[model samples]
Target: MSNINLKTPVDPKDAYVLVVEDNVSNFVLIARLLAFMGVQKCEWKTTGWGVVDFANTMSRVDLILMDLRLPHEDGYEALKQIRTDPHLQNTLVVVVTAHGSSAEMHKAREAGFDGFLSKPLDADRFPEQIKQILNGEPVWDLGI
Candidate 1:
């Protein structure tokens, strides 16, 4: 869970970011990037299973960077649950998966993802990207 802080955002460094990825190494890299950007509050959830339930346990959820592939249900299913929840209906959700492709990006967009970011996330660009997303700017990149 995260405190997105979109409207009159506090600061990218202080935003609540939730990353749902099954890969430890990938999560580590993302964590390091978030830390580098001075993001103090970041949470981790390994799978799509019970994502909404887990998020309900958090104080706030500003953004969710979800992986498409997971041990349990896929990101689409998780996103569906998120959209259906009244508390989380307005939350920002983005895709961060290795399987970045035109078709996949289109599918994600059609599925109602707020944004799309391809992985191997660029450490240099990720912070700025987060800032843009938090500021309600569109950030749909194909990891190019």
Candidate 2:
């Protein structure tokens, strides 16, 4: 297990992240994990609605950690919106969900999510996953 420091320095502010999760506790946990992984700038949205719009407005959002379930549009819908947009199509999205099942994983893959993380997110693995994504590696671990 790696020890994460919540105050590491990131290269650029524009390398921000968007965390779309309705649960406050999950949000906090993810936010802290991001901070520890050297991602200092992040935007939090409780609902999946308007996520595409928010992401579009940003100059550079390196990544998005989206929850599968939300009050409004679900992460699948949100991911579709993001992927459909020409401007935001290249953005990386990682699905974070408590419902970690083969079916959900398949759906996320079909929805074009860059990665998937099962909650409760392991603090050690969380940072490593983020690092892998940032390094231009395929975020999904579809173990054969």
> For residues 7-105, could you state the per-residue lDDT of candidate 2 as single tens digits?
333343336888999999999999888887678888899988999888877776777889999988999889888878787777778888888888888
Put down candidate 1 lDDT per residue, 27-141, tens digits, no spaces. 9999999888888899999999999999988898888999999987999999999989888877899999999998999898888888889998998899999889888776789
Q: After superposition, how far is residue 138 of candidate 1 from its true place, in Å?
A: 1.5
lDDT of 2 at 88: 72
- lDDT of model number 1: 0.88
Model 2 spans with C-alpha error above 4 angstroms: 1-14, 141-144
Minimal lDDT window, size 10, model 1: 1-10
Each candidate: what lDDT? 0.88, 0.77
